[model samples]
Target: MKKQLFISIAAFGILLSTGCTKLNETVLDESSAGGLTDKQAAESMIVPVYATLPNLFTHTNYFALNEISTDEAILPYRGGTDWGDNGIYIAMHTHNYTSTDPNLRNTWNLIFQGISRSLTAITTLPGINDASAKTFLAEARAMRAYYSMLTLDMFGLIFVKEDPTALSEIKRGSEAYDYILNEFLAAEPDLSSDVTHGRMSKQAVWGLLARLYLNAAVYKNLYAGQFTFAGEDMDKVIEYCDKVINSGRYELSPEYFAIFNDNNDTNKEIVFAVDQRADLNGHNRMAYFSLSGDQFPLPEFVGANGTDGPAITPDYYRTWENAYAPEDPKVDPRFYKENLSIYSNANDTCVPAANFYINRGILRGQQYGLIRRNGVFLKCANGNMLVGKLFHDTRNRPTLPVDFTEKVDFSVEGSNYPSGYRVEKYEFSRKSASGRNFGEANIVIVRLADIYLMRAEAKLRKSGDAAGALADVNLVRASRTARTPAPPALSNMDLDLLFRERGFELYWEMLRRSDMIRFGKYEGTWTEKTDANPQKRIFPIPQTAIDAASNLPGYLVQNPGY
Candidate 1:
């Protein structure tokens, strides 16, 4: 396994200021000029490109921009004090963010860091004449394309940098769309056919192409009142999705939660993922981000607790409830998975098992966990664990129950630690039993189920083939046969139903914002957000980036309505 790459801030600043120039050889930890072979040098150049993914997808950065800004999640102040980072979370949920928002700025910098590192590899890897170097070059190009696509999606612009010493030509609108599409197309053929875990592969490129084409209409005209999904674009989406589906290399996991489990590195559903194997700079924040501080999943590590971050919005929860009305949504295998087997009763207490698992899916109502007293976990008379109803333990509200309410208030005073329903989609890392950063669960970027949904959406959009779309949606719903009474196949399919189905399968996965925009539902009011401005569809260019490029006037302009 490759060790995590560490680049210093000064070195990164030089690369950024120099317009994505080739890094100093010593920056890659070279002791001597001729110390490494061609293949080793090429590998070294590419590692940093992949290293940027974990930070880019950190819960507070890109994930926040994608989910919190949409109806899927919300992060509010706890007791009008905690998480009140100058109202940034509230501004993001309510669509009042500016270029100066810290989350936006961090996401912008992380995306460009990936882009810059890819450029360094693309420019420097060619020096190695070995055949293996060619494959690395293709992967570098694909990484650059992926970062560029994110740039277009978030900031409505792409930086086209070819010469390391020269200024980057900024592309926007159709120009940016074509550039990103061509980059992926150019790199697809040379990508390794064999699955390389964290690295980009041929199937990963197919998945990325399908995603790009599905959102082509939006990228072509970002600020449009309503995006016009073209038949050709939808055809491209179906074409690429068919390539992945027909390859016989991937499948839907029977246990829905297993797809996000700590041992999911080998799971067939994942196409492209940020490999967070042991020893890499993996973070467990995704697992504990939405969890209440009082609810500790791992008994061995009492110190490893939740930060009481974002929670699922009631509007999103209602979608699940309304879909399976009369029957509880939890009955659907994808909706919820109860993993705490030992603590079955409200007054249950037993020796905490080493393999304790937390409940997955939309968490609601009262929560139960190991009791902590006087900064120590309580134990039974037989030295077993004592499990009971939890209370607020971190935010100076110990008397308040840790019951997650469905409806969350937008105002600071109205919001509390347990205001909204929490989601535990990803499993907590056993390796990081003592901290939040040593997780080992791969952050899935593309997966087979999402491919099926993309194909289903394309089929519905292209010709309104309800049967074709229904078959695809049912395939995903029915594949989760591990739980009793799998999600029943729907007899009907439409745009509205397809949109809701996507949410059912792919919520809290950082796809909600783009999904809402593509389905023409972004401007609709949901929970605290009431802004209908189309210009808010894409975020503004970070003011810091704009100022850095001030020397070159008109080089980096902010998106409209900043």
Candidate 2:
């Protein structure tokens, strides 16, 4: 029998009682309603908390806020038509978004849903009075802290709710930072050290702590003109990073692309990720979001298509291009992975192949894929597949070739079907043949490379140990030995170079915005964005959230510069 954990409507009422708008109240999974053992009930309670992650991290919501708003990506109005979405993408890219923006509202709601669900588990799990239930409670608290940290990063405030009925006490500045840090520290003892896949574990806690400490200055003074990286905080960051590094539970993946592949759930490098396996509700938007509509990756499902979403900005592309000078960034194992092995020539009439995989990493120039005639895929006389050059799929100019150009303009003509280079870091899901939604690739939130980078940054910032920092950065750079002509290590490292190295290693993973702010480049002009206002560092609280809490006179105040 399928295990079903049915959370009652009253439990949902508790979430809604807080007056937060758009709280997802649906049941987690559909299973035959029946009595469950205490062990089963505890497990069921924690499942919904984990389920909230997929929705929170979806490309349109959290991803848009983090990537599109920074120089790493741009989502312009394609050919003056599609993806306009009431100009939210443009507003986000330009930092002109207001409190009423749907993306902000949606992201805010989704995060709170995670917080609320975790809170529900934290409050109810103790009733079981079992050893497993205690562990589940610890996991719930840790998840709540994670959601709270995200809230602090985005909205400049953290919500603290003891129970469901009363309003949440808001914390900001040091209070917020301390609360999040303490929550994790408190839960660490009870969190299982064993790898639990999607669930919170000890190593995940350590990674999260390292991340929190690495950015301690930013959290401590969010709107300050300049942040002061305290030595003590840096020490803590190093301490936590060392814990994960020496744990022997993880090692860097030689093939960098395999870290984000479809079967990456068991990958040792992934410390924490939003689990999106075959049986769960995983979306392939991360894989197909930036792809051209004309490109079809899956041979089995011709209907599976890309939505032509945001692409890597020229400003970000230059970081890789100019990094090694003369030597093309393509040589770097992390930069690109060639997967279309059967067909090398774009003009090939037919190639014998049972499987087809598209090239990964930063894609440029003309794209090649299986061609279709009328409603059927074209095949050779020998029953092999035909590969051909791709053009725009009628949504844009059909005659225009799908050649990605680096120089993207803000104008309609400049933002054509193929302007900025598209990223294919995450592997396309084979399970979702009909559409680009059900992806099995677990969206990585924390990994070993990031841990190493965090430690390096802390080492440099805390003590100006340039040599020590360089060694750590090169460790990550040299770990990708799977690719031919492995990425060369840097002879020297500085703050600017270290920042660029982070981009080269971790771009499109949704860490760019925070990175830019912490590195003092958030105010720097890039491409079309020129506003250098400090207030733009944190997003305005959603107007809907403010309106929902209107009953409480000063409970939910909006962030400045709305």
Best-matching candidate per TM-score: 2
* Model 1 lDDT at residue 466: 91
Tell me the spans in candidate 1 whose CA falls farther than 4 Å from its real position. 1-34, 342-344, 412-414
For model 2, name the residue pairs that clash. Answer: none
TM-score of 2: 0.94
lDDT of 1 at 290: 87
Best by lDDT: 2
Against the reference, the lDDT scores of all candidates come to: 0.82, 0.83
